[model samples]
Structure formats: structure tokens, C-alpha cells
Target: MSSRQNILTGSPWEDKVGYCRAVRIGNLIEVAGTVAIVDGETVKADDAYAQTKNIIERIGKVLEDAGASLSDVVRTRMFTTDINRFDEIGRAHGEFFKDIKPVTAIYEISRLVSPDYLIEIEFTAVVGEL
Candidate 1:
């Protein structure tokens, strides 16, 4: 069996859900769907762009803990409630992975865990041995 390691992001969900922000098994690190909520509050509700940025930031922390970086990410999934916010969300997502350009998929879902949440993102990265 492959050894596993957990990655944390200092979010209350880490305690409440009894799960880590990310987990590393072998060369793969899978991150959970991270929302824009920080300190129990949504960072940007009106601005989909800002919300996307905030969500990615949380996911970034998980990648860091797994000894991976955004550049190492091979795939990503974004969940949004409104389809109209594609441009806004896409812009924000592009800001970070501009150079690396990970394969990404976005979906306009009915709702999220909370109404205030505008976006949630999950990532998968391949970790290389040092």
C-alpha cells in the first residue's frame, strides 16, 4: 500500500469535517473543493472574480503542504452556481495558472454547501521526489 500524508489549511473545516485540505499518496496530491470562505466569512460575494481568487488561495495552501505548487497542478475543477459568472471566474483562475495552464473544467451547479459561497475549486497535482 502506498503511504499517505495529509495537508492542512488552518480552516475550521479541517476540524469539523475530520479531513485535510489535501492528501498525498505516492506522486498524487488531491485537494478538496475549497470555498472562498475565510475566517468563517465569504471573501467576495458580489465579485465572482474575487471569490475565485480567494478560493484558489485556499487551494494553494493545500498544494504547498503537499510539497506541490500551482505549476505542478495537472487538473482543476471549479463549481459555480451561476453560469453567467464564467468570465469573472475564468479571469480569476487565469491569474494564477497563466504560465503553467493546467487543464480546468468549470460547472454551473444548482447550489453549494452554503448560499454565500460563490465558488469552490479542487486541484490535483503530481509531486516529484526531491
Candidate 2:
């Protein structure tokens, strides 16, 4: 069996909560639920579209570090605090996966870890080694 690999972002929560940003085993990578947090604050706090876009871009980097790309993503799960914002969030998701069209699910939850955070996303991807 291939060895397991862990990807860490060194966020305090990773240590405090004992979780990393992502993990990869062979060709499969699972990125942890991600929030659009930058410099200790939520990005575009009130704009779901901007926050979703920013989150995807950050997730793209994490995937790249794990030897994969957004196109390699096979599934995505999104959680949001407002169902009314679905159109904006979906528009941002379509921006990246319109062609890739990965399987996905978006849920309108009551809240997130932070009140400023309107969404959190997770990704699963399988890719060949480079």
C-alpha cells in the first residue's frame, strides 16, 4: 500500500484542534473543510461570491501542493449559512468547475465557525502522480 501523507497549513487550529488542511494517499487527495480566512479574518465577509471565489483559489493552491489540480477534483461539498445566497455561491463554483463539472452538494446550514464566515468548502480529488 502507498504511504499516507499529510498537508499542514500551520494554523493554530491545526495544532489546537489536531487537524491539517489536507491529506493525500497515493493518487487520492482529500482537502479539509476550508474557510475563506486570511490573516486571521474572513475575506469578503458580506459577499458570498467573493468569499467563495477566494476559498476556491486557496483550495486550488492546497490541491496543487498535494500534486493535483482543480480539474482533478471529483467531488465538492459546500456549507452555507444562507440558502438565499445559493445563486452567488453557485456562480462562483461554476467559474472553476463549469467545464470540469465535478459532482457537488451545497447545503444551507445554520451557521459556521465564525459569524463572519458565510461558507466553508471541502474537496476530494484523484489524480495521477506527476
The runs of at least 3 residues in candidate 1 whose Cα sits more than 4 Å from the true structure, single-residue gaps closed, are 38-42
lDDT of each: 0.83, 0.90
lDDT of 1 by residue, 24-89 (tens): 998898888888764344465667887888877767766777877888898999999998999999
* Model 2 per-residue lDDT tens digits across residues 9-99: 7789999999999999989999999988643454567888888989899999999888889999999999999989999999999999999
- Which pairs, if any, clash in model 1? none
Off by over 4 Å in 2: 38-42
RMSD of each: 2.6, 2.4
lDDT of 2 at 73: 95
